[model samples]
Target: MEKDLLKTPIEFLKGVGPAKADLLKTEMHIFTFGDLLTLFPFRYIDRSKFYKVSEIQSAAAEVQIKGKITSIEEVGQPRKKRLVAQFEDSSGRVELVWFKGAQWIRKSLQIGTEYVLFGKPNFFKGKYSFPHPELEKAEDFVKSPMGGLQPVYPSTEKLTNKNLNARGIAKLTKALLPQLKGVIHENLPVRLLEHYKWPSRQDALFQVHFPTSIEALELARKRLKFEEFYFIQLSLLLQKDRQTVQTKGHSFDVVGERFNTFYAEHLPFELTGAQKRVLKDIRKDTRSGHHMNRLVQGDVGSGKTVVALLSMLIAADNGYQSCMMAPTEILAQQHYNGLSELLEGTSTRIALLTGSTKTARRKEIHADLLNGQIDILVGTHALIEPVVQFRNLGLAVIDEQHRFGVAQRAKLWKKNAVPPHILIMTATPIPRTLAMSLYGDLDVSVIDELPPGRKPIKTVHRYDSNRLQVFGFMKEQIALGRQCYVVYPLIEESKSMDYKDLEDGYESICREFKRPDYNVSIVHGRMKPDDKDYEMQRFAKGETQIMVATTVIEVGVNVPNASVMVIESAERFGLSQLHQLRGRVGRGADQSFCILMTGQKLSNDARTRLETMVRTNDGFEIADVDLQLRGPGDLMGTRQSGMLDLKIADLAKDGQLLQLARREAEGALKEDPRLQKPEHAATKQFFIQKHKGKVQWSQIS
Candidate 1:
């Protein structure tokens, strides 16, 4: 814990010094001893034994061979400095050669000498030569020294240039193992360690760095992986227990019959089965004695807003105030308009409050909200202002859940005597296992089905070579009097990147649709707020025939008449994001289409992404494929890995483990709520170490 406890260069750590420390820091991002301790290898290389050319397949990537040097020869110019030292083992002979670093290679290598040469033995010009391989003296090259496994740290380009590549990381690990203090002697309880047969902290660190065998490494990993899930679960359960202890609420007993009545009598549309089930779930939670912490997840245009509205109405019917906070002003306004129109015949007073509201108008709205005159208030993050108080806030529905931090979302709970029941909505669908791991404190409801009458967006993949042909299709769609959208990756390319910039794309579009009468508007991340708003307003009003922009328009924008979406370099987007962009077009009554434009040259993964877009309109199915393709962290938006975090325990590969872990965690928490007793001591210690005694991060991340 002491930052300056050790200030020695890595090379001085019994095996490293100034030069090696510089190499390690510049190459591996390792500076402090702590950094070296946590600098986990990406993989483990098996250097357990030596192999011969005859013993290895011709297609083997690499193989280490123990042999005696049969001969040595010099070839190439002085600058090239090539040297070949042929080695012969019982199975066959392989030549160890060096080209550029021959000066060191020649000093380390000799003819008629036994040595250990580690490299791929290959036939180049009718003979074998290792470009540059690891060579050790015959005496020091004890087969047991490398007879088991090798750690392969993540290396960088700088590492390669510094000649501190994979082997360098391995060397650093070997040298630092003795210096590593097992901060934990037996952090986990003895029972758990014995039950799981997990390695001790000291054993794990050593086995992971230099394992005796693959089985030991597997045991070491299991020890750490179990700790990651255990701590995460313990922290979540402790927080949940802490909150449940201080109960807040005058529980609403309404069976949500009013909503069903309103729907049956005045409903012009039908509620999907998923929506009804979700509404029932929320009603049960709200009516129960406990406060509700619920998340509603749905695909874009899956009618999540309507679900939120119904929940708010249940609160309003019970004479309690409810507020829905949208991340964007446009979405807030949309909610206001829809609710105001829906509850027109009811006594539920509703109003819209946003940052753009006049000072005079805001003052009146604030007065109304505080007096409980407004039963339903809709606004942006402006609703969180200390000045805006709700008399009896019973429900807080947040749209686009990820936009707001947990601290901000919790603000609404403090607004009233009884902390408001929370309903969070997200257009971005989450894989169920991820939703559970991340949102364990809350209940989740998913709307996997789109509403009836909404058409699936037809998708097609296009290459730049077919740009002119695509332009023809766009013109044809425009001739139908419907609007179109062309989304670009970014406003401009980065310094290193040479992709088509948005401004460049905009200019080209103008050149193609050159008629002065044609209306084309550009929107991107760099534009001023007012300018962006104006462009969006124009596009929404049908005043602009084409909206060429970035992913900024993917969320909170509603345009019904737009029938075509063209996403440039569609390979650059995540599957969820691409699906959200496509959702923009299908709102119209007319048949809509999404055209994905990717580069002519595509990798297998990129091709799979494009093909997935062309194959299905179901977001859940696409999401399942996405999880299979990109792992949970990438799909969920961040990557972190450990006992406190994780380096592996991949959610995609071990999804079943997550399920079992969740079930085990829930059962454990129910039995040992406080986690204070000796039996739960290990779980308690795990969370305490993870949060440093702060339970909040566990509740959120």
Candidate 2:
């Protein structure tokens, strides 16, 4: 079989047998040679040089040394065994200690024999030592291919037992590289290659796997990053373009003067700068000849809904119907209720459609919508049903882009005579570079400023030791006629996390608040739809003061009365998620506070996260920090959320690169909109070849 082309079973790969193959495929989701090759390492280690015995501190770290074993001893009992070895090189001496699994090392090591050790270098009493370090004989020295720069692939505890480490990956790549044809596929234009100074595809692949120098590694990394960002930008713009062509964006002549007069005379409150800016942008898009594929992003409580309402009003005043789709039934009901109150005396028709509605009622609503009797229809995914149709759908606004699928988008488009202008909204603020790269196809408007009189939510970090204090604060808020939210992470993802802790948390709260009079509604992944709706409605109505929930409540169902949000074990959460939870509060007029309770022992990254939460309320700034702290895959559900399709780019650290790549892609699209010619052949082929994993990767184009 050709080395690069072979479809060898993972079991046949060097150093892997049936047992390890099972572990790889079952535990780590790794299968086949190609799958292993694409499994990029999560991190890398630097082993530039050997450390001096005198320089070794009490701190624990891996150290490389040339040493000979001077003495050996067994110290612990049979039940908990430990082996200790004394070593001395030409310069100084150190000790090697093994715990629990001592016999494996004892057999691997012989008295007075020299060996290489990799492990935590520690000093005890007066001598330098390594506790239970990885030991190998002197003959194994030549086998260390990763002596300097090493990539550490993500692994499970089960796989580590099989000794399938970085070298195993290198060996596999080595076997496969030569099998690749000499004149392998080239998917980048020659002009692009010259402008970006990119290496050939074969060279980049080989160098990325086993780079000979730092420069080679950097070149390989850059080529891959460019490809990643370019593909993502291309996908986004393509999707946007496709939507633009498909949707006619029926022209709406909204009488803004009346709206302006209404605002100037009876607006009642001052229009926030953000609101004005967003409204202006919306009006321009609605009136433009081309379809408006725009995304409106803002933080929670920044009045994004009002801007959306005003945009819908533009469509309504133009004598055309509009629709707003929310992810949940509760939110749809909420929007209907809000609109019914806001447009009480106006002729703009408003109706609600959800899965729970009676068949007769849904049919009537659908008929009314078709006859232009209803001006605006708000609902859950039920809005996409084939029977639901609009008479003159001029503007369509979708809240929370992630919740709706492409099938739904098509469903939405079919509702209109000339498909409505698309307006997408999100309460989450993504980094600018990422947004441009990801949503570049659509026009983007950001409401960066919060409304006046909306006080920033006071945030603080606490340890488990201050549990009583947190409970005290909760009690005070409850007594003050305010409600609280206790959010827990999903118990288990896909039977992956059945959080006994979730129910345990609810039970504990039931025990603590202790008063039978206090109503606490519990909601988690296990609950039925009605149960969840009941709990949410109860909480919304203040029938229940505190609602214990999972992150499911992060997106919709706004409560102006909830003022306190207490997140337990908050360190377990990412920065963006923490911000989202904080967003659940601060929506009401009463002063709001977010308490992030963590454990006493926190990792460095966790510390930075806690500090960021306490030090600022800026969502964009926090998004930047989140990107820096965590790469795209872990930051925003990139893998599953289907939003992030980056292959080699880091949205946080590689913003400049993303910007440059997006500029190039956008320029390329402008020159040849379809990328059908010889000039764009390479880029198009690259997208087809490389950006097809995980998500459909269609959203990028």
List RMSD in Å for every model shown: 4.4, 4.9
TM-score of each: 0.85, 0.82
Per-residue lDDT tens digits for candidate 2, residues 1-701, read 32344346778776677888888899766677756666665555565567666657656566777677888888877887789888777778778888867776677677777777667777667666787676666676767555656666666666667665555555555665665646456666778779878888767866777677778788888887777677777777776776665445666665664355545554546778887898888888778666888899999877777777778777877877888899887677777887777666665678899999999998899899888898788888888888787788888889877667667777887776677888888877887876775567788888888877788999999888998888899999999999999888763443335367677888989988875668898877667878887888899899988898888887666888999998888888888889999999987678999999888999999999999999999999898888788765564443235556444567778888888878887788788777877877767766755546633544334
For each of the candidates, give the backbone clash count: 8, 14
**Whose TM-score is greatest here?**
1
For residues 462-526, write the lDDT of model 1, one tens digit per residue: 99989998888988988889888999874244622323477788888898887665689888666
Identify the runs in model 1 with alpha carbons over 4 angstroms from their true place. 1-13, 16-39, 55-60, 69-100, 121-129, 155-206, 244-246, 255-262, 479-481, 491-500, 510-519, 526-538, 541-545, 603-605, 620-644, 696-701
Candidate 1 matches the true fold with a TM-score of: 0.85
Question: What lDDT would each prediction earn against the true structure?
Answer: 0.75, 0.76
